[model samples]
Target: MTETPGASGAPSVRLTAGDAEVTILPAAGCRIASLRVGGLELLRQGDHYGCFPMVPWCGRTAQGRFRNGGVTHQLPINAAPHAIHGTGRDVAWDRLPSLEENEAVFSYELAEPWPYPGRVVQSFELTPDSLRLTMGVETADDSFPAQAGWHPWFRRNLGGEDVAVDFSPVWQEERGADHLPTGDRIEPRPGPWDDCFGMPDGVDVALTWPEQLRLRVTSPTPWVVVYDEQPEAVCVEPQSGPPNGLNTCPRLVTKIDPLEITASFTWERLG
Candidate 1:
């Protein structure tokens, strides 16, 4: 692991494992600066992982209005017409006291002035074994239910046409039009995949490379959304709740009347 100074005086943290080297920007929302395995960039730069937000981002209702506990509370859509990843990703975080050279922790308070009144802290630690990312979200108000997760873009060799993912459990099929759940479970088959899988009791899932590398993600989140945009890239997102879980399935939402939610993901390279 190596520490360097990033642009605008941000702390640049770097970690190397097998054939991957990952860099994280602690000040710019702790976003991933770079992810390269075997000298190949997996996270698309100038496209994704920019100075946007910290990981374990949050998603509220488009209008910040949802029915909870038989009451409807309105929330302002920070991003007009759509509720985007919560404030943690966009806000500057406070660097915490550290003891490990390969690890970095950042904390931020999402107050009532914001659309959502919550406190979120994210930590990114790189070691000789793998890269560990963790996030914790807590709310001062007890009535708001929030959802959060990671949206990482994994590097894939699309030209080989042999890239495939081995999911841990059956996934709920989504309506082609709205991309929401259809309440039906189906097995993995051929063709394009843009669906979320309800993770079933597993610490790790394998993503096999055609000829070069195999990546495994060990996460505490119970679901993983796999998106395969042909000729673009593959995104295997580890999420705490299902997509549109708040709007569609009310039970999946995390209730925080003084609420707290935590999730993590660990990535390791295997040859």
Candidate 2:
């Protein structure tokens, strides 16, 4: 366990077991800043390193507008015409009291543009062979809507070996001009996909770096977005809902039933 000094004075925690090490930033959106196996790094460090959690709502909200209980709420357009990801990643997270070396927990309260008074909690647990992540949202007042997930920008190559994605999705959600899902489910399409897919049984994606490392990402959610447009990095996002799920298929979060989701990324050394 360790902490790094930053501008915001945010503390970074590092967990090491055997030849594996993982670093996380609790203040900076509670993101995993780095993950290394043996001596090789698997996740990309672009602008922000490793992966970050998406809470309150995952992905984007079309035009940043959504209707709830006969009222239309408009969110900030962080990504031009839409609100990509959620406000959680752009704000600081409060660290929760914990004494474990391999485990850390952080929480963020709902704020403006979200229109809901709630709280999101994210927890990370790391071991020698795998990393488990869990996210949840709850409100004391009325029921609202929410979603959660992780956006991991994986390195395209590991030890000079190119990475290849392998997954069997039932259908792909057709994309529109603005990159939003068009509500049409088509057959499994080709690679270089920046679209969402429907995995009825759940989301299970295998990213293989040839003979170096092969990581499997699994989640209970039925939606996953695969973006491999760039040659430097590929993103396999395990989201609770699609890009425009708020407007397409909103999942109500009641006082008794808060939205919760969990996902894991486990890897093995390839021969």
Candidate 3:
């Protein structure tokens, strides 16, 4: 494991496994400062999901108006009038004890009276071969709705090369221009893709580089969202819900007395 100085100038922990180098910021709620695998970086800077990356509402919130539990909630537009991700990414997190060298646990509580009333705990682990991230959220009320996912920015390399990705299952199509799902799915042909996908168990997603480097992501989650803005990097986000999930799955809007959700991804380098 390697160590680096954090934004606070204090000693922060950094772990290097094979071609992956991860920096853990304990003071900043144990946020993942950087995650690079096979020389490809994922997880955008200044972007987080409270501790990881918040989904359900990734990107914009659409004027910050959405229905929840048959009631409409007006969320502040952090990025314009859109909700943009969730509250967890911007909130502070507390560090927890762990025995794994590359494992980190963070905890946060949104009291009953808090803006986003829910208790959440997140864990991030990076191995020499892969990365595993998980999150659990519990609420005091049995009616609060929640969605979770990771937002990592991946590098496309310096030579401006196109990376190819392979998924086990077909891709899901979006219902609207806002990138919401239409409850319909399709196979990924040669075209622009910016939507969630349903992956089969133990499915392998590979990022083949022109420089002869291959990065792979294997996970239990059935859905993966491939996001790219060109010339920067691609994001292969594994999510429990599609973008604008509340609008897509109204039943998921209800609050939970105590809810727990877990999602993970593994990254490895190929010869």
Best by TM-score: 2
Q: TM-score for model 1? A: 0.76
Cα-based lDDT at residue 250, candidate 3: 36
Q: After superposition, how far is residue 33 of candidate 2 from its true place, in Å?
A: 0.9
Say which prediction, candidate 1 or candidate 2, comes out ahead on TM-score.
Answer: 2
Model 2, residue 93: distance off in Å is: 1.0
lDDT of 1 by residue, 1-271 (tens): 5778876566677766565577777666667767665575656564345323422233334454556667765545655654555555665678776677666777787764354455676667665445676776665555445565666666556245445666656555554454555666677555466777766673356667666556676676666667677555566666666655556555322343332333333444443
- Whole-model lDDT for model 2 versus the true structure? 0.86
Q: Mark the 10 consecutive residues where model 2 has the least summed lDDT.
A: 1-10
Candidate 1 weakest lDDT stretch, 10 residues: 252-261
lDDT of each: 0.59, 0.86, 0.61
Would you estimate the TM-scores of all the predictions?
A: 0.76, 0.95, 0.78
Ranking by TM-score: 2, 3, 1
Best by lDDT: 2
Kindly state the number of residue pairs that clash in model 2.
Answer: 0
